[model samples]
Target: MSDFFNNKRVWITGASSGIGEALAHAFASQGAHLVLSARNEDALGKVAVKCKELGAGMVSVLRLDLSDHDSIPGIVRNMIASVGKVDILINNGGISQRSLALNTSLDVDKKLMEVNYFGTLAVTKAVLPGMITHQLGHIVTVTSLTGKFGTPYRSAYAASKHALHGFFDSLRAELGDTRIKITLVCPGFIRTNVSINALTGSGDKLGTMDEATDKGMSPERLAYKILAAIERGDEEVYIGGKEVLGVYLKRFFPGYFSRLIRKARVR
Candidate 1:
């Protein structure tokens, strides 16, 4: 069991599947108390059961739709009341887009922003006060590699991720005096249903996985890295194959990186 997460009250969003589900197993193995949240109540229940089997001391399931930003605070408050204080908040629930900006509808963009940006912010705000009062907390987000740089066929998705980086980075700076730690986990690509469920130009599901995603890193591996980053109190970390190098390339050679991305087939 990991000493850092042992008995910690950790709340994980998107716990229904993919990276979230993998993370649930990883944290449970360390004997953490878990609050698993996702839009699908049934799926969350399944994950909770698995968590218990994996050695979690406590496990609770909460249904949360990130698209319903307005109701997030109420949901979070009720959760906190039942689960006690939240030691860590994993803002991992979000959708992905697969269309170009020119072909995408405004509604699609709005929905993406609402779920990936506003919804995350609302949950963090609702949980922040308690963490602040207790003077101990950690906020971890599963941002994508696109958060650091632009890529083809993911304009809205990239925008939402970039916004997360801006908000969390600023929040970290503002909370410098506090014990609250913010870790932004940037994953290049992970084998999941993100591509299959990605929004299209007309706000429809893409309904198919891409080649890159099919060959991406396993969710379980990414989960292990994320847990380590959290334990180390890393402000930010990248997890993936060669795709992760894009972050450094974009930083050191923006002009070259921009040109290279233009010719790259992201999807």
Candidate 2:
């Protein structure tokens, strides 16, 4: 029950399941107006119903496919018209990778960048105008531990997440002292379908869950942490267990970090 989110219009992509779905419920409980989006319209509708049940101010289901860049602008326009305006945007829609770089096809790499990098960029640009017009907004991106440091099986996925960090960091510098805030959430393994949905070298789903991922933090717990960071206007926040230390380890002890990462069971 956060007063800050009361009646606030919050738009979340990939809201059909996993972390995105948890975020919707978390925001709803705080009385926020919810705009849920994903490729699966039926799934989004189901999430919308749950949001309404959770005491959301208002809930709207909007179909969104990140891969379809041309349709993003129109969807954003309609979302604003219907939900009034997006006060807070959760950039949570993204794909993951789980294949060695050498085995991975170039096409597979390109698709990873297309959805995770270009698709994210497209949505942010489309929403920026409205946030600017309102003179207030928050952009929360759900990057991963890979964004800070790379792993063996997630070459292109790491690249895409790394690209997000670069873009958002520059955007924050450009904004300077503005009411609009940006927060990059770099989470370690979370209990989600991300592993099963991860892309392989051939561009097919991994279709299996990693052991560490199975024992990782819950989405409900991470959602609350994200909400707290947004309220505080934090530029960046890392949420996870020991794996999060890799970000710092890479920075201060590159050689040691490299050896550890190589031996780590990323999959």
Candidate 3:
């Protein structure tokens, strides 16, 4: 792993905490140069220090808010100015939702799309030109299991993730002749602040963790699987416990899976 990633310039969004932070540690241990971005600059700074201590060749902190799509080009410019060209870009910044389809406000759905789908798309576009010019780069998106199939309480969230899968899958086909590769990582659930930070029907934070999220896999373990998938150039990968089986269930047993999901306890 160290030999594969040593001195590679990697950029990760949502690096302030959770899976993103764990990925920072994982990549740092492999001696990768890292650019960590998130809305919280102070938190990013703390994570940057930890990455340095973990043996990162170089670590830089950049403030990035996925909702602020207008500022993305400038951020990418600054990143290129500082780090030259990124070898890999981990599109990990996004918001989750725990709201019902009918109860959720239209504004909340728009906000979800703005941050989860368009925001990631914006960042990927900004970083793509350089990668195209260099003829080498890996684009990784941290999608969700919901991306594969819609689930309860995540209508908007699942839609946004599903859009990413469409966009990236098409982008990969378009760039098939290029050296650049795209990998979409679908994580079922992880013990993180995601549930607590999930948006509600009123567009406010849920402010509480769900039982499923609280008992999910650790961020560190998921990060390892993600990096391994990137190394292997996998087009798509799923990481989770038994919940990941839902993907296959939906695929091979759509009727049963649909009925099961109807009765499943998502929250």
lDDT top scorer: 3
**Model 1 / residue 94 / CA error / Å:** 0.5
Give the worst 10-residue stretch by lDDT in candidate 1. 1-10
Cα miss at 238, model 3 (Å)? 0.7
Return the clash pairs for model 1, or none.
none
Model 2 pairs in collision: none
Candidate 1, residue 226: lDDT: 94
Worst 10 residues of 3 by lDDT: 1-10
lDDT of each: 0.94, 0.92, 0.94
- What C-alpha lDDT, on a 0 to 100 scale, does residue 147 get in candidate 3? 98
How high is the lDDT of residue 236 in model 2? Answer: 95
lDDT of 2 by residue, 1-267 (tens): 359999999999989999999999999999999999889988898999999999998898888889889999998988788777889999999999889999999999999998899999999999998888888899999999899988989999999999999999998888777788999999998999999999999988999998989999999999999999988889899999888899899999999999999898659
Candidate 2, backbone clash total: 0
The order of the candidates by lDDT, greatest first, is 3, 1, 2
lDDT agreement of model 3 with the native: 0.94
lDDT of 3 by residue, 1-267 (tens): 548889999999999989999999999999999999999999999999999999999899999889899999998998899889999999998889998899999999999999999999999999999999999999999999999999889999999999999999999999999999999999988999998889999999999988999999999999998989999999999999999999999999999999999987668
